[model samples]
Target: MNWYVVYTKPKWEKKVAEQLKKSGIECYCPLITVMRQWSDRKKKVEVPLFNSFVFVQLPDSDRNLVFQSVGVVRYLFWLGKPAIVRDEEIKIIKKGLDGTDSCEITIVPFQIGDKIALDSGPFSTQTAIVQEVNNTHYVLVLESLGCVLKMKYK
Candidate 1:
């Protein structure tokens, strides 16, 4: 079996993954919990590691079943064919996000000006740009709101 990436409706990755699992399809939607602050208090919430993407481990015969799930947009394809992802790569993602509370622990490569999103807290689903970088800390510039946030990353 090969792992394939399916694009889901915005903010629907977890729901689609759950529905796929109920139908006996093997699905993996990596998530991370991040601390979010509101005026009242602080809380931790789970969010998708990759927005709008869910990984399904399936054979070619089961491809259509994934499409039947609610909120699935389509398979991510390359050259008109579904792209195949390796088992090891899936393992890496699973292990990385398993118990993390901060995004800084991730080694996923990013460069200046790269846009990323806040998955939890008051800024849930907000997009921001990477304006600076370092091993332990960095700066994120939220352009739409005209705010600059300094965050720790390690």
Candidate 2:
């Protein structure tokens, strides 16, 4: 048996995985937890590592059952052909899932309560309080300006 990508309906990867599992197909969908803040409270949500795609370990004979299943978009390749994913990559991903490495660390975003020191830039070697953490940048309250400034970190 080999691993193949199964294209799922929009935002239905988990549901498709469930259905495929019920049909005796082995499915793997790795997820990572992210903190989502709401008006009243903050919650940790498990989001898919890949969007709209679920990997399945199936042979050619069982591929038909998944292809005919509802909520599956396709075999995740051009013209419905099975796309090949390198076994080494799958093994690495599986190793990550198995906690073989240090991939299970919770990366807490630099939030208001957390302290951060600038590694470079005009604020290099300076410590700043995290006012907000946004996509592609971090809004920091510089001690010199008494105002918030956005800084990009790789």
Candidate 3:
């Protein structure tokens, strides 16, 4: 079996990972705990280390099974081929997320329209879809009322 990256629908990483495991597929979805603030209180929440992506261990023969899994969009391709994730790289990711490595957390490249919550700040726990990303900051829109929030993290 080889490690492959599966791209999932927005915010579906955790659900997809659980579904894959329930289907007897070997998979890894790294998560990190971060402080979330609400107007009333603060709490720790688990978020995907890499948004919308899950790592699965399977042979080429099982590709169809993964495709049929819930929330799976497609396999990530590079250079016109399926990108194979190395075992060592997976280990590194685990270590990094585990805080056993120099980096404490991993932030995947996020796209506009991506759903996210503020990890640390006065406005935490506010779930919003990304409308813009400019370097370390983001413009997010609260879906219900179309309110906008601009946040920056160092």
Top lDDT hit: 1
lDDT of each: 0.90, 0.80, 0.87
Residues 47-90 of candidate 2: C-alpha lDDT, one tens digit per residue: 78899898998887778788666789888785656786767888
- What is the C-alpha local distance difference test score of candidate 1? 0.90
Q: Encode model 1's per-residue lDDT on 56-75: one tens digit a residue.
A: 99899879998788899999
Sorting all predicted structures by lDDT, with the top scorer first, yields 1, 3, 2
Candidate 3's C-alpha lDDT? 0.87
User: In model 1, which residue pairs have backbone atoms overlapping below 3 Å?
Assistant: 36-121
Candidate with the larger lDDT of 2 and 3 = 3
Task: Please list all clashing residue pairs in model 2, or write none if there are none.
Answer: none
Model 2: residues with Cα > 4 Å off, grouped in runs: 78-80, 103-154
**What is the Å distance of residue 126 in model 1 from its true position?**
34
Q: Which runs of model 1 end up more than 4 angstroms from their true locations?
A: 99-154
- Deviating ranges (above 4 Å) for candidate 3: 100-154
